[model samples]
Target: MKRYDPALYAILALIFALSCAYVPLAGRGGGEMTIEVVRDGKTEFRAPLGDVPEMLEFRGPEGYNAISSVEGVRMVSADCPGGDCIRAGTIKNAGESIICLPHRLTVKLTKESASEMDAVSY
Candidate 1:
């Protein structure tokens, strides 16, 4: 049996970690999702997935609406008459949305599609 070198193991671990990180950045799939808040058919807020605040508040004609994104986008509180928006549940997947008809507000989750496959060139 051959002796194991500590440096070799560290190098291998670093390489593996880097490769894993690169795969997601290469646009293969599983890209970061975006949160889009639309009010009266206009985009009130739009941001890419990142450090989401504990509570995101938006002003509507009815009153204020609050949402959170700890795990996924969800309505935590609202001033609307009906609580249907709160019952919409957490929306994490792209195309999912929570609508508050009374408030005339909509929060939707979306993601950017990966680029087309690259062809090898000699």
Candidate 2:
């Protein structure tokens, strides 16, 4: 049997840790993203799957009437009474959102993974 070298072991451990640290984690594969909107602040909107056109015609109170892609994610059309929220625009990154004060609605985007994201709060 060969003698164990403590120094060699420590160096190996350090290399392993450094390699793991540099390796891209599972959630780090994509660019930073977020969705921001205002919906009474109590409820949040789900990130839309399709493009801006598809989001416009969903046809629901919470459905987005006017949407814009500020960055990457889609800001769905809102049902705010004044139609202000509808015109707020789209967001797709950390720290972007739309607000509808009249209806107490807001939309915001975050860095959480798409699957993990509960709702795109703008």
Best by lDDT: 1
Candidate 2 C-alpha lDDT tens digits along 3-104 = 898999999999998889876564564554544444555544555433233432323355444455544544355565677655655555565565666555
How far in Å is the alpha carbon of 65 misplaced in model 1? Answer: 0.6
Which model scores highest in TM-score? 1
Assess each prediction's global lDDT (C-alpha) against the native. Answer: 0.84, 0.54
TM-score of each: 0.66, 0.45
TM-score of model 1 vs. true structure: 0.66
Q: What does the lDDT read for residue 90 in candidate 1?
A: 92
Model 1 lDDT per residue over 1-122, tens place: 55898899999999999999997677555567889999999999988757567679998777789999888889999988789999989988777789999988999887766653233243
TM-score of 2: 0.45
